[model samples]
Target: MNELAFTSWTESTWVGFDTETTGVNPNEDLLVTASLVLLAEGVKGDLSQVETANWLADPGVEIPEVAAQVHGISTEQARAEGRPLGEVCGEVAERIVDLWRSGAILVGFNLAYDIRILEHSLEVCGLTSLEERAGGYGPMVDPLVWDRKLEPYRRGRRNLETLCGVYEVSLDDRFHQADVDALATLGVLAAMVALYPSVRTLGREELTDYTAAAHQAWAEQFNRYLASQGRDANVEEYWP
Candidate 1:
């Protein structure tokens, strides 16, 4: 493995990403939420200028109470303010694809969900898949996986909020919404990279590959923990 210095990554621009969904299955889940924030070097833009966006699209199904409780976007409100599902998903997919094409690294706390959902949305919109848009699936980063790999035995929750706290990054907005979550994810990612300078030298592809295996290991370990705690470990859902 390339033991690259992490400071080299500081020069790369990262697009912090997050999404809210009606459910967990990308193929069936409707994206009721989405956001992207640019995290460039030397200047962390105003949380306001972070280039954020959100949506409450009609899922064409009843909004589950548990999911609604997390995001507070209900079916009625979505119907009142939401655009057609195709339009909203298409717009989000196109915007991110354009960013990827422009060479910004896609960053997030748990980016797999966002990427998978975006790919599903693109398919639904008859646009190219995100993997295709990014030219053979590349240049993405996720701080959650980074943390797990860098400190496998460390304690405490691995959620974005928890990472923000560990990183001393402020959480200034609603937690589950896409906009704030994306920014928070970005902050956590920056802090992790700064803390682990070894990762700075990793090319985007290497970083993503490392994160993929680390995240899978984390999920397996977490499921065992949940089982020990007598909780139902829902494997199908993204570990949001």
Candidate 2:
């Protein structure tokens, strides 16, 4: 495989990943659904060159009403239709590792959450973590980080749906489904590269370092603001 670099991102393979979980906490929550949407080289927005893999896990716990309302996956439905949690976690981890080994850049919106959840799930299942398997977590692109860095003053929600709107990317499907979110993330990234020459020009390692530093800077500023308001704040200073 050719060396992975951001300069040729449009002609490189990308794997957009997303997960829908039972709750908001990565440490306590369980993954209910996960998806990987692959956009091959020279095929941005071309469905014909895309491939996808999706999974639903039984989770081994009740899918809370709030989470079910968000993702439309009831516990009863999951128990009946989903695969075992260990099986799902192992498959998802291995598939992601395989893609990384094949030189695909991972793309997501707020990917750190998903990556942490996956890491927790693998530990729970007694399986190897993604980092152990892949030797590292990235080459990755997080549209959330880039959007915040590029347009810091544009203040509204930066969630996936809002980003799709901001970037003029279509989100034709429902919001919380893992597959739909993954595809929407890819669309947003494609739009970002087209609009921001800086994003298009960075090399792979350079972009990784840039985003990591950017996230740390944002975390520090946010923490200071929270401290001024007398609120407890400890936003993570790492990137995915």
Best candidate, TM-score: 2
Note the residue pairs that clash in candidate 1.
5-200, 5-201, 6-197, 6-200
What lDDT would each prediction earn against the true structure? 0.72, 0.83
Q: TM-score of each candidate?
A: 0.82, 0.93
**Residue 196 of model 1, lDDT score:** 75
Worst 10 residues of 2 by lDDT: 1-10
Best model per lDDT: 2
Clashes of 2: 0
The digit string of per-residue lDDT tens for model 1 on 1-240 reads 134344434556678788888777766676777777776651233444555566657756677878888888888888888787777777766777787676678787768877777777657657666666556665678887788888888888888887788888887857988888888887777666666757766765576677776777777887888989999986542332
**Candidate 2 segments exceeding 4 Å error:** 1-6, 42-49
